[model samples]
Target: MADTPNGATPQQPAQVKMQVLAQYIRDLSFENIVAQKGTGGDVKPDVQVQVGLDAKKRTAENQYEVLSKYNITSKNKETGDVLFAMEVEYGGVFLIEGVPEQQLHPFLMIECPRMLFPFVRRIVSDMTRDGGFPALNLDTVDFMTIYRNEIERRQRESSAAQPTNA
Candidate 1:
């Protein structure tokens, strides 16, 4: 390792610390359309999952709340009929320290949700299985890609909103 002047070691930035204070389901809904209708049988299901992430600072110092919302729908591919629909909003309370101010937003959006995803996945699986359907094991979500896409979308919208000289 290269040393600084007088052979002193280079300083290292503080290591970031994060802790999950609490995590729980904020809301959940499961509608079994198949049971109600009893229409589709042995039909291939097309499942669509939509995800949304949000974070807010808590009243307590160094605490923040992150929410992961999922809307899932399963439809018979051939019939275009819904088999099931599910919505879940899971939240986590985090105590974060040593993150730079500029990096905090991305940190909250990416890292906190990464920590909470497994639990959310499990809950979804359990809910679907208990609803008399095949357990839905959700694929891992790419938080960084989602964050980047959202930022790009917002930038495009902002640019489009600005008035240009005719």
Candidate 2:
């Protein structure tokens, strides 16, 4: 290790810094398909959920916008009837600095979305509760896993889309 003029070991500066400039609800929807009083109130519904992620460079220097979208549908497996549904698109403007290009994608996809998830989850839960149902809590998502899976899927699609001849 190299020592500075003050006889102290030099420390590395921050490699990356992320700031959430603004966050807002880009879109939201909620529907209650079944009446709570119609059934016997013993209906255990199975919920299907889908989640998506995206990031784009804004017209600003060292800044990017990240969006996380989710869809939830509740259905009664036995009766085959729709109970409720919800969809949300949440986004945040992030200012990132000092990160290398190779690391920027992960930072934007994983870190930025991780920061915005709590708010989105809250919105979903509140919306469901307000829509005449119990509050729905979203499970903690593994951003790293999702990011890796998406990368692999895109690579496979691109490779298959290319032409090959014997």
Best by lDDT: 1
lDDT of 1 by residue, 34-139 (tens): 9998983578999999999999999999999999999999999999999999999999999999999999999999999999999999999999999999999999
lDDT of each: 0.96, 0.90
True lDDT of residue 14, candidate 2:
62
Error of 1 at 60 (Å): 1.1
lDDT of 2 by residue, 9-56 (tens): 887866778899999999988878876436655778888888899999
lDDT of 2 at 154: 93
Instruction: Give me candidate 2's TM-score against the actual structure.
Output: 0.88
Error of 2 at 58 (Å): 1.0
Window of ten residues with lowest summed lDDT in model 1: 34-43
List the candidate 2 regions with Cα displacement exceeding 4 Å. Answer: 1-14, 36-41
